[model samples]
Target: MIHGSVVHDPTGSWDTKAPLDRDAHTALATAVLHWDQHTAPAPAPADVEQTALLLSGYLDRLARELHAALETLPHGQLPVRDHVAAEIALSQVRRWLDGPSGAFQGEPLAQAQSAARLVDTLHHAVDRTLGAHPPTAT
Candidate 1:
């Protein structure tokens, strides 16, 4: 069910600061690398629904993987904040997934778009977390 690349800051927690601070060189780099808006023409309702379902599943799986990694990574290699960040980030993604995802509430398209962006952000965020501090080679 997973698809696409290019993550973004759907939760806005990536930078862990104000919008202007993102450009500040002194700011600690966030898990987010980069992101872009969806530019394609509006999709059909069916397409949107399918996309949402697929992304929701993918995001859920990715979050679980990240959560497990955060919990299991060898000690002395992780800062407490690393686990904290993973908790907060995954919580935000899960909250969104739990919403509207059940019944495709209010605006189906909007829900779908939200899922798309969340998935994108998570993709990069998870990558940043593991990539920056990869497990030691065996």
Candidate 2:
């Protein structure tokens, strides 16, 4: 059995609980940048707008999940290897937000990009935590 005081994997499966919604995330990213590729862009398609909204909702969820994963570890200690990936993902999201992509660029694209980044980081953090080898029984 997986060793941990809190068996929080809701599914009770051996695999990590956090799964990246890559399809939605990819769609959001594409929607965000699609307008830029057009010379004279028309209104965003219905699907694009919907994707943005979905991403926003997912981002909130992702944030919560990340917070929970971080809490699972001992105080001030982390699975360094996995945690590093999570950190990188967080930094990537931050960069995307602070960059022009975050400004929304007069559209939902920037916001979508920001949401995508959060999701990306969330996945990284969770993967690292769940994959970590628990402290061996002494």
Candidate 3:
């Protein structure tokens, strides 16, 4: 379902273009923030199928957006490690999407929580690459 490989064109988009546009970056940031803030509550047995469907769709959309963010990376702007992490996150989401029953260990909310966490990870990486804010000292 989810592949682990990360592919990039060395002389491609980022190499020839400016950094991600402010508007695009902001939109991605907003999406990340929204997903981060919205946590899925546990679903009842009857609604499990519907909840799984919604989460699967959300994961699909988020994966596309993450790919877009990756394409917008300016050369040398973000470390290669960040990009790899984003790819891995996307793959994790994909695995859930491609699952036979779309269940994460037999729990719908658990699956959604997993996907949301992956999205959060990608969002943080993209935000860092875009210089949205300084990483807070822990």
Candidate 2 lDDT over 1-138, as tens digits, reads 887485565753443356767676766555565555357653565655566567655654555555566667675467466677766665554454456655344556555555655665666676677555367698
Stretches of candidate 3 off by over 4 Å are 1-43, 100-105, 129-138
Per-residue lDDT value at 17 in model 1: 32
Residue-pair clashes per prediction, in order, are 2, 0, 0
Off by over 4 Å in 2: 1-36, 39-46, 80-105, 133-138
Q: Using Cα atoms with residue i matched to residue i, what is each candidate's TM-score against the true structure?
A: 0.58, 0.50, 0.51
Off by over 4 Å in 1: 1-41, 79-82, 100-103, 132-134
> Which 10-residue span in candidate 2 carries the lowest summed lDDT?
7-16
Cα RMSD to the true fold for all candidates? 12.5, 10.7, 11.4
TM-score of 2: 0.50
TM-score of 1: 0.58
Would you give me the overall lDDT of model 1? 0.58
lDDT over C-alpha atoms for residue 119 of model 2: 66
Better of 2 and 3 by lDDT: 2
